[model samples]
Target: MTAPIPRDIPDLPAIPGIPVLLPSHVPATAVVPPVRRPLVATYRLLVALIAAAAVSLELALGSPLRTLSHFAIQSNILLAVVLTLSARRAWTARRPLPSALTGATLLYVIVTGLTYHALLANEASPYMLPGVLTGEAAGPTGWHVITTQVLHTATPIAALLDWLLLTAPGQLHLRPAATWMLYPLTYLAFTLVRGELLVPGTPARYLYPFLDVARHGYRSILANALLIGLTSYALAILLVALDHARPNPLRHRLHHRAKTGFRLQPPVG
Candidate 1:
């Protein structure tokens, strides 16, 4: 007395195969894009956590306003924000941020690391911020050293790694390099103008020694700034070249799957 099965549905084999009642219209490739590599997910998660920890220490130790006043700390916070967002996109299978924006973030962190190591880390320098990048104190200084490593070393390296290993290749272009240089230049200009605005009591906020007009005359600072800008442009060129090299993680994963005889099931739809 039961009604007949629908004509649109394919009858299941009597050998007890997958249930015909369930829909299997989706393609296996749609469910598992190769760009969602586990290695990348792990890297982004660690980078987000490390960058977050580095910036959090700044807020923990003192006034949040004062902590963010430092360019290095601020740059670290920016990287943290981007990494968090990028990670979320990556994990959720959404398109990643545009290469230019991602490249700028990477360039900023690299500059922060390079400036600290080249100009301030090894020896006594007027630009060195107290309780940062030092290892002398027993309890508190340990945190500074750890935080410094996270901000300067870990973030920069992890960012570069994500670009090289996780993200797809050939997205960056030559013109973006010039555009990337602008962010640092604008920051330098803001630092100088703010220095002029500050009252003559608190420490002059030059951000970096090379930007300090009084210590190093405008001429010398100009040369330094120009050099840094040129370096940034060159680094951008290198990044573009790397992208052109086609270090695509997704392709690699797909190739591996193919070689391993792992084919996606054809969709029914």
Candidate 2:
């Protein structure tokens, strides 16, 4: 005779169509409430506005096509869009963007700033377009100066601040760092193709000096590109490392309260 099945235990195999459920004693996982960060949202929104304004001013004041072709302009535009969305998410207590997207955006903007300061800033006139288009043969001034500083200096610094001060840490991964190189690589290809299509004497045919195939030749241009690519990869890796190492500034207060068993009390009227 077959052993009798326990009455308390439903015969799950026999009841194939019936759903099995957990015991009442088992607790369901708690859902965490989303945190609303108004200050973070406001700051991000301001930075986004600044970036957008700078890009707009550049387009209006200079040759629109040439200005749009610049890596700095492109990166800043990405930053503006990303930050605007991030600001809305923060304000609404929505889940933040994926770490990979935020990290890549940060990396691109940093690269823009670093490349400008390290390579282009030292040029007598770093404007990609000729004086006829930019009207800055003597060097950028007035609104040009403001836009330049905002795009290359202020925007990157603000982004770094947002990441460091507002966002949680350890979200970035090493694998994503490698993937972040895709945009830079694509930009390199675009620069080469665009340069080839333009006539040799066309002003700003090659937007950046390092990628100027006409002057540097394909061999030298490739070498320069390789060096920059490797450097950018290294920077990305470093960013990932730093991200993992950084503490969660946004959670510090909560952690401190939990550790110390502290609670907030309402103020007496």
Candidate 3:
């Protein structure tokens, strides 16, 4: 004979035409709260304001806030912000932090487009490096030079890596090394092609100002590249970590209060 069923275990309950087992006990689990919508909206608005300031800066300075291309990019970022906010209101009813912040990063890139332009602009200066390494100076040399410089330089690769970092499939894993290496790899290709290191008339390395800190007056280009590489990787990782950071003390207190209020609200009995 089968052993008697335990007292704690409920037997199958038979209805006229159906059989079902009912559990006697169910344990609840702690649920992780979703990132709140208002938090994302708050951040999105801040990014929007920053973008607006960039526009204002461009107008005041009577120059495109980076590249003229950046103006269109800024417009796209604004569009993304509006689209994201609208979609959240209509569908999720809460803005997602990741999506909103990705848009913010795009906005940031647009704002800094001019800075990159300034660095890469072509001019007839004795200081700027020539041909393969420097690309073109950012002065009045027109789009032909600017476009040529961009094609020759590592900016495209760097931008592609930035795009990848922003839109990686799942949870945002910060790959700082990958991001940092793109520029160096591209520049290295250009440098090798020009034989800038071995050639007698190696121009100044200021074509990549960021790389100059390690250049040591054109003596140790690779060493400088490595240094810049390390610094770039470090900063990228730090920024990504900081981006994913949860609430700090003050924010934690506010969040705690909010969660407490949510929990204390009466549920329909």
Candidate 4:
């Protein structure tokens, strides 16, 4: 308190104990925004239209209630609805649908195609009019043939392409794959119950040959159901494995550019 402070202080030597503070440096990262995909939208929309048209043709040509009951028709209906919404989302750059729904839709449609070809194509379907397959009756001509192909072949291929080409990989999981079996199992129950309710000799009383309770009885039908269920579960497992193994097609280009030290630009709609 008694000593007076000097008016001017001499330049002091750097103190070893003092610490200097400088501005922190941060590395810049490129942020990519969601991009609208017109091509994907258009492709999905076309596929949806194809599925819808096939379902509509079936409804128009056959009994609406009976046609609607078929697994193939129901699966196609789901595909159509889901794809239509997916197309809108793609166009608007919205978040895609949950993996569970999209994966189930794909699996169901694929199963429909496989079932048609493996079990119903060469053989007579219960849904088909009597004598249609034997050339004894005037069989379905131009539009009917187109409808069948669209439902069983074209639509399935298109859906698979959408999954493989457009969507990101590794979204599917084993748990959902296991859960996917539930709908098919429920359908089995429904088919059995419906067969029981129908009168004897009712046309298409039991829809498919494998599930023909009158001919095969409950014992054989259950056995057939078990075999088919196991096969379907195996297919589901294969799909999950394939999904995880597949390369990331959607972001490869962006990744490549980033590695090459090029400025990454967002994709245009």
Candidate 5:
């Protein structure tokens, strides 16, 4: 006797020209009702806990009047989540990553590096080291500098996400929950290497609490970092789930093309 099909795999949609096969002469398209699995239950519980933790952290900022600031920061976080989720979906669906994401990431790194160099032109500080390492001499007066180290650090994360979601087929089955942990891991690595995370000698420190608190005390910094890691892992799971649930426009187009007997071919090299 053949083993029964797992329940989490949803029924295949009725796409014309596609054939379904099954073992033991059974029809693969036969309607097998979905079952409640223990894994799904655990996943849901984990999501709920993570959502609660993130909200608590945001609220713990300790001021009802700070709603605007909290909202602003959380909104950015949400946008990041949306972008990541969208990217993941596109990648999972086998769609090329929009050049906009890579471009935007690069642009941010460049702008951040330039801002660093501008702020600390002659001033010596740990922050200026990154600016020096990545930056190119701009004229005799140091009017502009290009920071390549910042790009090196940031670009790899983007490329990893792209590879995980876009290039690796069926990889999600094993690393679904762990993939999101990359956010905190990358940030932690950045902090250890830089001794200070995010922007330094910048006015934006008032807006960013975690980086602001790094100088307060070692215990406080450790606590905040742990919170960040936990919240990030949670958010990753949420993003993955959201991405899986949502469909992409590019994917739809590809499906249509595939149905019409269009074969996407690489240019002969």
Candidate 6:
């Protein structure tokens, strides 16, 4: 018998019309009964706890009336909403999240983590380093630290870890990235309208310095917004690419018997 072909070396032969770039997971159309596993249960619970803590801290921002005005708080609220909703199915019935929801949430958190650090973090503070690393917040009080870091740092990291380690992949497509713009676009419209209505002399009329048209000039700010939107779409493309990079099928079979493993089996070239 040919010594069981070593899975470490892929043996795909290049044949005409044969698929080389096959999906790495079950097809999205596969019919299966809803199910729950202990491991999936654990992951869902962890995500729920993290999201809840972040939002609770947000609510404790000392001024219940004014807390939602800031975009950072709004985005984190959105993040909490998405994370909670995604976990519901698992929490109630022990099922994994749908691929599309998974991909969209992943992209949103990654974008959230990236945008805050790059464009908004306090460049002067060393603690701003977390924001920098997340590729990432500052709060005056202990609550601020928890909420801000959890929203900008911990939440994003948790969401990413949910995708990169605990979840299976191969459910995303290019078109959904286009759909992901709805939340951001709607939020932008709201921000602009609210900023315009603020008292005439308000210097920082806009929540973000970059979006403050009175200070930056409409032409300049619009250009910056357009550039950021383009960059966001580009990031969406990368998110789609990552979804396709499921753990290698060969490696899956090779290590099928492993228990409670957390290794990211690199895909074969």
Alpha-carbon lDDT, every model: 0.69, 0.78, 0.39, 0.79, 0.37, 0.61
Across residues 1-269, which tens digit of lDDT does each residue of candidate 5 receive? 99998879978779989787655654432222222223323432333344334334444533433322322223223334434544444333333334334333323333333333433333453223332221222322121121132122332344334333333222122253554345445654544445344466643333323334544555776675677556545544544454445444233323333233223331100
By descending lDDT, how would the candidates be arranged? 4, 2, 1, 6, 3, 5
Q: Identify the candidate with maximal TM-score.
A: 2
lDDT of 4 by residue, 156-190 (tens): 99999999899878888999888999999999999
Quote the positional error of residue 30 for candidate 4 in Å: 12
TM-score of each: 0.73, 0.80, 0.35, 0.78, 0.31, 0.69
**Where in model 3 is the C-alpha error above 4 Å?**
1-44, 63-66, 69-95, 99-172, 175-227, 240-269
Clashing pairs in 3: 66-114, 121-137, 121-138, 122-137, 122-138
- For model 3, residues 1-269, the per-residue Cα lDDT tens digits are 89997779778766786656788453221222233344434444444444444344434443342322232234434444553553354233332344334433433343234334433333533234332222333342433344333332223333324334322223234653254346445644554444444444344323344444334444465665566456555655554554456223223323353343232211110
Query: Which candidate model has the greater TM-score, 1 or 4?
Result: 4
Between 2 and 5, whose lDDT is larger? Answer: 2
Quote model 1's TM-score.
Answer: 0.73
lDDT of 2 by residue, 1-269 (tens): 99998779755555568787866652221123445578888999999999999999999988898898888899999999999999998887677788899999999999988877776665553334322224343446778878888888899999998888888778789987889989998999998999889888987788777787887799998998898899999998988899889877855443333333222321100
C-alpha root-mean-square deviation, candidate 3: 12.2
Q: For candidate 1, which ten residues in a row score worst on lDDT?
A: 260-269
Q: Give the winner by TM-score: 1 or 5.
A: 1
Error of 6 at 73 (Å): 3.1
